[model samples]
Target: MTGGTPGPPWSWVWGAPGPPRATRRRGGGRGERPAGHSRPTPPASGPAHPPPLYQAAGRWGTPRAAVRVGLLCRFAPPQLPAWPTAMATVVAQRLSHLLPSWRQAHQEPQPSGQPEPVFTVDRTQVPPLFWKPYVYAGYRPLHQTWRFYFRTLFQQHNEAVNVWTHLLAALALLLRLAIFVRSVDFWGDPHALPLFLIVLASFTYLSLSALAHLLQAKSEFWHYNFFFLDYVGVAVYQFGSALAHFYYAIEPAWHAQVQTVFLPLAAFLAWLSCTGSCYNKYIQKPGLLGRTCQEVPSALAYALDISPVVHRILVSPDPTTDDPALLYHKCQVVFFLLAAAFFSAFVPERWFPGSCHIFGQGHQVFHVFLVLCTLAQLEAVALDFEARRPIYEPLHTRWPHNFSGLFLLTVGSSVLTAFLLSQLVRRKLDQKTQ
Candidate 1:
């Protein structure tokens, strides 16, 4: 009675609530029943109902899209003296919209539960540029962005664009390439234009890209050469893209046979392969990465020597844990093999169609392989991000700023998605032929 409910909890007190608070009374005393007698299912307690809001992925949050936007906001340049508090307020409110009725937004619990919920955070829901997908891929670290990026200001690092460019580009190019391949008439050149340019542009970009990095560090004179080459490579990409789609526009019916489509492409190869016709005046002979045949056609102009050096370095076997030089040597071997693959396929030969060029049947598979390789580079990027984490005074924070950590996990998930789709697509195509 002192606590308000004049009768005992099990006394069938229905709607007699002064306030809802924990009420306890000695269960053994004044029960008017003998000890050990099964307490008759202590009538009904509280409301015989569950709360209106349901538990999902642990703490209840508002709509998912709102959460992703909150994440993107975390990367904004350092706030002015008057803004951290202001920005904090706004971010908290935005997060509140996502937190379900069961949980408060932005308020992390004393100890978050295990098997955290991975939400579908949409960057668009938060603002002017809504389409960008900046979901928190992994766990947010227990620190701020400043604590994560380390740099005083949000300056883009060397590998910033390198990683995002491929990631963002992959979405668009992968789709385009897949469609172009599907549209092929098995013989027609017209519809297969995108693929043609994609290969050329990819090689040209890669060649110049590799050249740019390797020489940019050597000297300014060499730097200029590689820089110009990089630009020229971009120009080639533009041409390849347009030519791939419409080069044979004037002769639509000619694309009826896949061989006809690709044969003219073989001519284009002559253009790509013959690169080193001019001496570098500076770069040594046996040259770093190019061919020198002035007479060969455009299609066979470029060589594939440098890319292996880069691709192998990407997934280098752990140098610290593995035999230190073994990883480097393994990468070296992969590098040369990739280079050989490129040179053999792109380089001109007297054997022409009968040579190992016939072995280049898995170019489509290689495209997927490229995607996997890029993901590996991204994992390295995340490692870099993790390494830059800051030393805060154990701030009173809720969520951690483990962006890189979350990103690595997300990469794995994407790989799984890719594997499932790859198998399914292969099955469907294989079944159609039988």
Candidate 2:
């Protein structure tokens, strides 16, 4: 009466009471027994044992009500079946573990407080299709901002190796720089500008690549900015290479004659490469024109820069005087081409998506090739410097700011211009979304 209708008379089978003897005798049969029967008691009533949970239903309420309360409270008596109780506990524990992560990923923020750290989330929880494909489940570490890069360093994400590879390369180049300055007259020597430029370019290339990889998961805005900066770094590095070749390989007379033409051309190409990259990423289709625009200028710069060295290699008939740098130069070209191919085709991963998410991906391979290419270039430059030492003139003495100034001006102008254009395109994109 307190909760609901009574349970069945025989519910006492699991150690609870049944109908009274007089009541059963008077009724004369099971079919004659009425509803709302009081549960059975112990014959002597000294103290009846607590009933099994299933049998206790008549005492508290109906069988259905007691079962509902038992499940909700997780208070199933010792007599309840073991397997069902264990299953319920497991379900509850699983929900408890998963709910917090779900809330962190999905819930809106409190306006009155400081921002919470952006934790990594799975693909389903991320903004739909926000990242590149083949990244797979664990590889996608979404919502991690720049502030969390330290934490992300230890996390097992796809970009982890790509970021660290370039970072280590940058550190190696720094050590190489220290050794280089100690070995040569870095500041005092006039011809050291090209060497300085080479070091700077190497540092820029690695640092930009690492930063781009690090910041890519931050947000779309940061992603585009860092990606463009990385592209600019590539252009600047190629131009720096060209400067090293021009300074060492060309005569001062020829340089004087061609400075007007070469400087403008280099600047144009740098700007073209950067601008084209930004356009390729944002606007253009990933077709032939877009690919050509992105790759051609840097490829052209490498071809031209290495041409003079290649010419020298061919012209020198003495096998003994053959430059080791020339062999490395050839290796560098092969590595560069390999890197480009891996980047465009997304090889290995394209063959088996998600399998290589944490390691051995195309981007990681690209970074490795880039590092090798830079090392090869450094070796060649060092060798060229040694070869030209006897005839090396302090050309910077003649002009206070010549190739160094022009090179800096050229790169700066191009980068700034490309950045502004990218900003414009990004603005348009944002407006459309709004």
Name the candidate that leads on TM-score.
2
Taking all chains together, the TM-score of candidate 1 against the true structure is 0.21
What's the TM-score of each model vs. the native?
A: 0.21, 0.66
TM-score, structure 2 vs. true: 0.66
lDDT of 2 by residue, 243-281 (tens): 776666544555565545564566567667777787776
Best by lDDT: 2
lDDT of each: 0.34, 0.68
Candidate 2 runs further than 4 Å off: 1-130, 138-145, 249-260, 319-322, 391-401
Off by over 4 Å in 1: 1-159, 166-175, 182-195, 206-215, 245-434
Tell me how far the alpha carbon of residue 275 in candidate 2 is from the true structure, in angstroms, after superposition.
Answer: 1.1
